[model samples]
Target: MNLTQNRTRIIEVLIGILATQLIVFGLAIYMFNEPTRIVEAQGEILNVQLDDAMTLYAQNCSVCHGLAGEGIGATPALDSDALRTMDYNDLEKVIARGRFNTAMPAWSKEDGGPLSDYQISELVALIQSGDWIETQDRVVNLGLAPLIPFTTDPNPALLAEIGNLPDGATLQAAVQLFAANCVACHGADGLGTGIAPAVNDPLVREKTADELNRTVTLGSPGTLMAGWANVLTTEDINALVTLIQRWDEVPAGILPAPNVPIPVTEESLALGGQLFSQNCSRCHGPEGQGTQRAPALNVKSFLTDTSDLAIQQIVTQGVPGTAMPAWGDRMTESDIQAIVGFVRQWEPTAPEVATPTRGGGGGPPWLRNNTTTTQGTGQQSTTGQGQGQGQGQGQGQAAQTTTQPNWWEIIDWRILLLAIGALSIAFTLIFMGVESLKARARPAPTEDKSQE
Candidate 1:
């Protein structure tokens, strides 16, 4: 072929390659703009157990792909047709090998991936039931399900046990006080660390008054988290419920969403219920009773005591200076109202809603866990895998064999795969275009002049 022909061919290939990009982007754009699909309230997808797969997705997938399989411009939808049409194994393959020529890269151990086959399989299985198609309300209705259903026997064991014991101040007041004074050391946000321990830690929130009392009375030495018994008043001591309730700020924290709105009528409540179960249920209990990591809503401390409007604000703004990050960007106003409605039903007798007791020269009943079995004294101890104390802290600090809870790891891999896949697709287009041009440029093999 002549040089002209080669150039012509190259131009055509380049055009085709560019067209492919337009096509991919066209399809991809729809996904970027569309909202995430929500699942049924009782659907296994959201209402299901927090297995290894779910955990992985939450940590990794939720970042760009979204918490409910919704995709952002950076990532594709995990629940919609883009993902649903693909078989579980196919998805697994994509995750493991990644789409070459695109940004998505292989994530398998064999392909330099982090997860094992088992973990991958678990992630795929969870995605199998993609109930993520349900449309979530920008707002939610806590009332759809009774905050505290009336039972014949009415065992308020969990509530009564943590309820009384003294703080008479308003829950909101405590929230302000703690935010102003305590957050600096205990993490103005609640997920404490380094200088401070995890004040908003799931287990720490559940400790009884006696436990808090003990920790508050005594001080944990060595650790920066000092005892604060002498400085604050008795009233301040009791305001901790506000802090305890907020401990559960995960999914980046569940205050409420802006796009999500509350549905008032039965229809709205039903809709809100559907939305909440899909997105909120993972952290808040399927029963809305509160998870180890999240606080329950129906409790008066966060409910009856505060106006519905305040709840809406919480949903939107999130408790600043707490683990509760804002969700306003996630939902619509209506959806936020609906979630408020949902919380109205979540009255767990009155939530103590106290913040974590920080600034302590003393260890209160709240900080029972600060001490390990090795020391009779109440001091901070880091136990990684429940493998006895003494050396526990040492090993944890050294290696942290502890993985990022399966779910978080999987999500991270998925993001890496998507990024690599995109890059691969881009390079593939350029390479194919270049090769076509090169092929066209080669002139027909010169006749053997020797024969002439």
Candidate 2:
């Protein structure tokens, strides 16, 4: 009897140990898969970041930098092998605090720019990866027009036969050619850029027609200027030489403005319009006309000067020391992009809007005294502590923003279900083990003694 009881107890203990081991095995499996899971999650996040960076690049940086980071006339290429292999920290710093005397503006908010640290990081990642084809495709998919089409020297083989033309027509052709090809390195009207010499200068004017022709035919050595001999015909070269020698003959505003129409789709316009009305109309008016609260967005000057990216930045990161509030937290990147598209539609024919007259209000809306004015009657007004109220409300909003749950914080139902199943199996095994022990512990029934 003692031996049987001992055996039963040992069996029960083994059952309990087996149940515990099952749980341990499940945990071990989970841990084994964790690295793969992390890798997959990271890859997904990188894809999202890259897509966003592409849009950012198209809207903001592509004007100077080519669509595929091929680099404009003077701008350095971001997709080059050198940039791809550059140290991560060095790239990040360059983006955060831009190079001095360079067109690359400091993009980080710490340096008084529109982008946040995370955004700067995304851009850096984009540059280092040097994968711009996918980026370009996405920009196209979004119906965002590249600010400027990439321009190259016109190929002579591709040119139409140059027939003898009147002096005026020849000069006009030369102007068009120069504007298209030379204007990139040499600034508009041959005024020149840092990389290229000024063609409109006195040195060129002093040169004989033959010298001008030779210089244009054979490019200046050890300089960015490449000879147009292979690209332009003799007639074209002669026309250019005449134009350069008599630069004064060209009228003002002859060069075509490098403005391309924003590529907005009907679908995009409809969606953008709907979103704009819902979110932006209250302050910016239905047609982006100036309101008592906000400046008119549909003005010629604003549309003409502000690039789509600039407008996007302004929308995402609100103007400080003003009534405009940052919508980065409240809106998705696509939503902001749509708003930019909608706003950009007004650029072609936008008219000047008169500025709204400011009431006798001092400082920004938040900084000014909070006043409650009664409707009609005597128009009685009362003042309250604006700063304190504003601060409190700001703090509350900040708290809400900070408290938003992270992706990892949310429970996965699959994991929960698995855990529950493991626990149920463990408990069932434990219960079965206890029942076997109880059965083993029960006293064997004494043989019947009725016959004795």
In every candidate, how many clashes are there?
A: 110, 0
Give the clash total for candidate 2. 0
lDDT of 2 by residue, 132-210 (tens): 7655543433433344343434333222222222466676678767866666555545765323567888887999999
| Superposed Cα deviation of residue 132, candidate 1 (Å) | 3.9
TM-score for each of the candidates: 0.24, 0.40
Per-residue error (Å), model 1, residue 145: 20
Model 1 TM-score, all chains together: 0.24
Candidate with top lDDT is 2
Task: Please give, for residues 1-452, the per-residue lDDT of candidate 1 as tens digits.
Answer: 46656677667776776677667655564443332222222232333322334444533343335435665444566676656567777888987765654334355667655567776676665566433322111101112111111111112242232234343234445544444444433443344412345566778878876676555433353222334455455666666544455445322221121232233544334445655665665665454545555776534455646766567677778878866668777765445555566556545433455332232233223321111122221121111111112121222222222322343433554455556557766886777667766665453344444345
- Show pairs that collide, candidate 2: none
Model 2 residue 131 lDDT?
63
